[model samples]
Target: MAPGITTVLDVRTPAARRQLAKTTVDLFRNLLLLLFIVRYSRVALTYLYGYGPIASAKMGYAALRKSLYRIFLSLPGVRGKVQAEIKQTLEELEKKLVPSGPGITRYTALPASGWGPEQVRAELEKLHEMKHTRWEDGRVSGAVYHGGKELQDLQMEAFGRFGVANPIHPDVFPGVRKMEAEVVAMVLGMFNAPADAAGVSTSGGSESIIMAVLSAREKARIERRVTKPEIILPETAHTAFRKAAAYFKITVHYVPCPGPTYKASLSHVSRLINSNTILLVGSAPNFPHGIIDDIPGLSRLALRRNIPLHVDCCLGSFLVPFLERAGYDTEPFDFRVKGVTSISCDTHKYGFAPKGNSTLLYRSAALRKYQYFISPDWSGGVYASPGIAGSRPGALIAGCWASMMSVGEAGYITSCHQIVGAAKKMAEGLRSRDTLRNDLRILGKPLVSVVAFTSDTLDIYNIADAMSGKGWHLNALQSPAAIHVAVTLPIVPVVDELLNDLEACVEEEREKQRQAVVEGKPKAKKGDAAALYGVAGALPDKTIVEDLAAGFLDCLYKA
Candidate 1:
């Protein structure tokens, strides 16, 4: 402007220069004010549309922590050492997970000559005998909800009948479609769903959870125009909900399930809700603690907020509905509760179905539609799918149907009595403190098949490792540092063995600790589980856990 001699600069004197400088400062101040407004306006709008200021601030803080941790890990010198350690751990993990020992054979490629079905079956038998968790003898938890031989035989027959069937081709495999529909209907009925309720069969509990989340998000989008969706979960809710949030770009809020009862803090959940909250989740005997959230309270909150609430009964399934019949007290946590929009039931868990079978039921048809995907303008043809997968395994659906039918209501009731009874026995044994260690305590009131126990005076993870050493596979939980056993039909008979091993493991750990204390050592009796959960619990930085998890997944694919 000075060079061009504009009118303003043409009057270049001391006073004029001072005036120009003043104007410049004023402009800069205005700009800063504008920036401040924009930043705060976003937060204000976020409060108006999403989680309120307190929750938003919490989320922002968590994000900041994550970003800072990421930055810390990005340093070249620090990264290299950490990576080297991770690599060594992964290598050791590979040996343990994908081991090739004396009796083990690694099949990296096909043989020169083609093998017959008999040879393949023989190889499979050997492969099955490899060092494993021994789920068959009821030493394993949650996994392999194997029904009796008769039920398994029926499921196998159904699978063989529909081995090549795909539900996507409804016309071609109408039987599979019918079986799926019937399975859903039967499951919904068991959950006390309304006449207008509808659902779709999914691959498993994870898929069912995914679809329920997707439906809630979509419904919010269409009805409330909520773009920035947020979901609320109990601290003990299944991890699938978090996975769904990550995949679907939804904000997740966790409300602590406090000690003693371990129920979701309803007040905290209420505070977390905002206009953009698409879903609220309560676990019907959530995986870790196996304690049901207050579904009635959740329902009241959902009704007041007009948000979809999902009951994750993937672990509960057949057992929960029949708990009362089985003489086990249960909280209301299903379609019977108003404001509960969806439920995820793993047919594989308690429905006595084959693995890879579950159902997601909606309270109404309108809610179910949101989970569907359709495109009429495709080049080839119109494409539509009920849930996530387009071409689902009809065999699994058939097996699910067969299992449900064979078991019927009576069989499920019997199973509930057996499994939940075993869980009750375990819980009773732990609480008795006469047979088990007095230092250990049960986590909350587990009303379902899963019974979680923690110890104030003992390292729970070390106890888990000791149990593992005794050929028992149980889930090690963090946050409270506990272990859980998911009672199944198989575990029902071996409940005594489980309690005995648990008591022995606790005593073993106590002795180890006593020895370490005498040797002037503070920490002792660390095993695979102890080290794993201890690290996971201690680290505020989860990058190590993430790295380990990724490597573990990679190991799963190794031949």
Candidate 2:
């Protein structure tokens, strides 16, 4: 039939014409609805499939618990009581943290007139002598990674020489620039990075991680046009990753690091991968448990998914790369592992550098450019920065470079052997000693310089408080309630004393538990750590805990 004849026949009747127009409108409406569904439901469907039913149910339960807590806190009498208790807790915290006595002087404001150099020096000496944790005596965990008095003198000299130099003006301070480049190059070589790899120096570990996260996010946005970015992180990964996600407005999917191995769950990480997953993170001996995640496993997943993988060696630093040379057990975590796009290592920790230096390395220079900040349209001039800070202290870079140069690979290997050996000895004592073995169990198989342990038969926080009373400062972990001692160079000589104190604390806590049971008491009396962690863990909403932490921070600034 002819086209004109068919059109004439089809539209010959008024009812037929009306039906055709209605059908056309219906088809257009249906097509628009289908497009809307596909666009809006993609992310939701990905989450459903990725998390599956069991994990989704757990998430739902957690949300419900949080909601219930909000309702409970809103109750009339409950709110008042909780507020009063929080106030009392903050007061106690302030009193303990802020020193106030006749002998102590508060410098709230600057002096009306400048003091002489001798007067300033005297004041500085007095301030340094104020009573505090004896980190120099190895009583504190992980805070001071001292490289010895000679290295300290070298660092001080470097600082004194480059005090006013800033790396932002490389032309003005070319020596500082050269030192910073050398520091990055040296660390990249340690991590087995390729020749085309590039890196930048940051203030510390947290900034390095933040830069890595930012790099991944920016790359995803520019290359894949992924606006709603998400990252998969092991639960044991550093809190800095969470801070980065919060700052960058990215979603985080936390895969659990279960016990026994306490490594990231490979299956869960694989399940969580989706189109929006810009990055996957695995730690090289995470801070809490000192257990390296299955980086090889994560690498395979990252390669298969075509997403970036970041290995956080901030804690491991110089120690991890030298593990094999130091004759210790090791795992594949650095650039030698395929599909690892970036790594963050703290030169400050194990590198024996000053506290303000760390490096973020990339597998390729192209990936690192995503972390750079540039503004060409500014009226002032074309501006660019390598990282978050505009003007970084060249003094820190010089100090870090000097430390690295002084403590060469041979020195680092020896340091690693000493620190790791001490840690292993502590773990062995915990396992073999009578009181410790009976009450406590080590978390994971720590292959590094940190040994974390928890107790099933006794309160771990009570043990922590007891250690504190004995002039030892240990790190407290939550979720499973544990304590960790990060063995540094200073702690190498005092391992036996640490083990002895730990044994005594365990025995004391155990005896107290037994006495409480015999007396028909519900529980033993709680100490400061016990009470603080206990209350924090029991509440579903962490607002009170946040407030307490904020109060502690405020006390640090109180004169």
Candidate 3:
């Protein structure tokens, strides 16, 4: 043997050997554990934090799921059965909504001779009488904001005076231009915008949002040389932003909102920012939850990053700015936030203007100029338009101006107080219920006039369908299935009735679900609402959803 060789292996006590064996095993196990983790880290990271190449893999899985569903639905028997069921359901719904008559007589081809104004007006009145849902009673949420007869009369009068006028011919219709400018000026004053701040009226909220996005995109491209512009928005931000992204060919990154509050996670937002980030968006009060983002924090981020910040106050409109003066607690989400570059507000929603009017406001004239579409080399001379539309209806602008003047600041404050107070009462009543208190939870701390509720135990969509049966038209939300009521002046008078109805509906749904479980009936897997949302929320291939949405839109025009 060699001189340094030892006899056998070094011996140790029993406890020491056991410890050595354990350590050896642990060392081997740890190596294996690390290998396993390294292998699955991509998946875990994607599932938990939505990061890395695994994100693409998850998207592929989603696409596969959607494709499988589509393929399954395309089987002969499956397609026929599903189509028949859909047809029956749609027929039932149409029967309930449409009046008893030959269904909507379409004038496929215009008459050789035009009907006179009186005849046309008479036909329009007849068409209006055939609708079932009386939105004027405020049965619908966020549809008809102000239904007072006085406002209607004022709008009609204003329309009659300016129906023939067009803002395009400024010299001939100087009054129209003046009124438009004044409307923009008045809205700017309402938000306390700086002297350099400017804006233009658009057809509605979507157009306003699109114009703002366009401005941000162009500004980033020209100023910062950002080629692949990306806009960061809260998940609760309006779907309009997605539409803008698609239309403008910009990238959109959604940041999730935190717990019970449903406000954007500023920490995650800070992490998401890259060199290509052109704009950061915060909603004053988002449509789904009616919760304002942490605008102060988002503004600070924008300031530090030197990115444009756009606040969507479309749904908030007249309510948010006036909440503080109306004796309700509110947050700072307006021009007061130094980094805010633009805002979109709908005059039609809470401003009580006629439908088809909204404002796109910018922090400065330099920013506003980016949104203008100008064609210098056009054959039809140098052409420029302030917003998306070339020839907009002056009648709507006139009506908007009239509505604003009629509902002065004091009137809005009073309306805000009533609506906000009623919404709070309804929320309180829901919270007080022992049955719903635990299972059902409000999405956020709503300071304005909207309240959204979801449930952990029961299907909230089923509750929504039940509420629909009771003639309460509440909005259905997804991601996590929930429903919301946008309280209006009319809802103020019937707040108790609404809460009572909601309680009854929830209880009835719970009973139905319990009976279904006891009888072993499949518990109504997921009704039409859930099925429709399932397809929408699941599909990574948005084109498939787009096709479905297009089909649905086409159905809206069915003869």
Local error of candidate 1 at residue 243 (angstroms): 0.8
Model 3 lDDT per residue over 1-559, tens place: 7899885633477876887789899999999999999868743553345333565577668778778878877789987886776666567555554434665567768889999999999989987786455565656666678747898899999999999888877888888899999999999988889989999999899999999999999999999898888888899999899999999898887788867789988876886677778899999899999999999999999999999999999999999989999999999988989999999999998899999999989999999999988999999899988878888799999999999999989988988888889889978988997766866799889988889999888888888877777777889898777889898877777777777778887788788888888989856566556666666676554545555555566566655
| Alpha carbon lDDT at 92, candidate 3 | 59
Residue 62 miss distance in model 2 (angstroms): 1.1
Q: Give the alpha carbon lDDT tens digit for every residue of 1-559 in model 2.
A: 6666645436778998998899999999999999999986885666677778778778878889999998998899999998898899888888778888787788888999999999999999988997899999999999899999999999999999999999999999999999999999999999999989999999999999999999999999999999999999999999999999999999999999999999999999998898889999999989999999999999999999999999999999999999999999999999999889999999999999999999999999999999999999999899999999988898999999999999999999999999999999999999999888988999999999989999998889999999999999999999889999999999999999999998888888888989999999968988898999999889888888987788788888888
TM-score of each: 0.90, 0.93, 0.85
Model 3 poorest 10 in a row by lDDT: 43-52
Q: On lDDT, who's better, 2 or 3?
A: 2
Q: Please name the candidate that would achieve the greatest TM-score relative to the true structure.
A: 2
lDDT of each: 0.88, 0.93, 0.84
lDDT-based ranking: 2, 1, 3
- Model 1 steric clash pairs: none
Model 3, TM vs. native: 0.85
Worst 10 residues of 1 by lDDT: 43-52
lDDT digits (tens) for residues 1-559 of candidate 1: 4687656463468888898899999999999999999978965774544455676687678779878878888799989998998999899999888877786677788798999999999988977777787788888898889899998888889989999999999999999888888989888898999999999888899999999999999999999999999999888899999999999999887888998899999988887788879999999889998899999999999999899999999999889999998887988988889989999999988888888988899999999999889999999699999987877888998898998888888989988988888898898988886746487888888889889888889998998898988999999998888889988888988988888888888888889899999999989958898898898887657988999999999999998
Q: How many residue pairs clash in all the candidates, one count each?
A: 0, 0, 0
Give model 1 RMSD, 1 decimal: 4.7
Best-fitting candidate, scored by lDDT: 2
